[model samples]
Target: MLAHARQLLDGSVPLPAGTARVAAAMLIRRALEELAAEWSGCPEATTRSQLVIAARRLPPTEAERACLAWFALSEACHHHAYRLPPNPVELVRWLSVVGGLPAPHP
Candidate 1:
């Protein structure tokens, strides 16, 4: 999902800037949610609150970053007439946040 989002932003995929940004944001959100579910040992990341709860378990600074990233990604994923899609920079920042999360141990 993160790779797809990177492709969307990197022009490997043909998408308008606005559309690609939103699509990338959506993909990043999915990746973040899955990471949160795993990190929290929850059955699933079924709600925004679940993600927040997961974020809160991290070290203080990381927890703050995770919460902010989740909020930004969630907002970016929505389609609202008055709102603009996230810019590449913002999406990339969220991607970094998602990437920074720990992967589940085998």
Candidate 2:
């Protein structure tokens, strides 16, 4: 599974970004499912929290940064048009770093 994750990071799979996101989500979901089965008494919330943290650690590449910027702007516009709360600007900054738009500050 780790190998598969690494492959995904390598960007050699030639899939669309949305497709890749779905695949990545599925992989994480499966791991959570397995972990839940293995640790019968563990809270699902804990497992989900840990998964989110781990997923956040998977830094994006330069190409991904462009995608994220476009995605964020599109989402913001959509929400604004509908009178929904705007997405956090922190998300844009975080995605910028993760997508390799810029190096994270020390």
Candidate 3:
């Protein structure tokens, strides 16, 4: 998902900015899902909304929390807007911080 977001933003896929925002939002949500399962131990979360609420129960860093908040808003409304598309570079940085979380111990 992160790679696809990068590809879309890098012009390899030639998609619109809003499309890239959707992909970026998805990547962030993917990170949240991982956090909800691994950090929060709520593997039953099946939807982004559930993951979002579950993530709040964990102790994410300030940056991670901010990224999650941005992701929620983007996923909820950015895809339908014509302006204020998310910046790919910022999205990449956010993914690097949030999506690059380490695996949990066995």
Candidate 4:
């Protein structure tokens, strides 16, 4: 997903910049949502609750940053008539942070 997001933003995917931005945000949001669910041990939890639950197990400082990014990603995923898609810089930042998450324990 991260690779795809980068491709979309970098023009490899051939999407309009704004569309690519939104698409990348959606992909990254899904990845983060899944990670939060796994960390929280509640696959069935709603996206809104997943982060809060996961934060309990995450490091104190990192959790706050993750939550802020998650919210921004969520908003970016939605189409707002009045607002434009998210900036590529924010998506790139999120990709790095999500990429840095520890691999799931077996």
TM-score list, all predictions? 0.86, 0.36, 0.58, 0.91
User: Among these predicted structures, which one has the highest lDDT?
Assistant: 4
Model 1 backbone overlap count = 0
In model 1, the clashing pairs are none
In candidate 3, what are the lDDT values of residues 24-77, reduced to their tens digit?
667675655555465445577554544455446545564356446556545544
Residues 1-106, candidate 2: write the lDDT tens digits.
4345334434677776545444443443343334333333334555444334433443444434433443443443332343543323433343333333332222
Q: Write the per-residue lDDT of candidate 4 for residues 1-106, one digit (tens) a residue.
A: 8888889989999878888889999888888877887887888988768778877878876677678878889888887799988987888998888877754444
On TM-score, who's better, 2 or 4? 4
What candidate 3 gets wrong by more than 4 Å, as runs, is 45-83
Candidate rank order under TM-score: 4, 1, 3, 2
Better of 2 and 3 by TM-score: 3
Model 4 root mean square deviation, Cα atoms:
1.3
Q: In model 1, which regions exceed 4 Å deviation?
A: none
Which of the numbered candidates is closest to the native, going by highest TM-score?
4
Task: Give lDDT per model, in order.
Answer: 0.81, 0.40, 0.58, 0.82
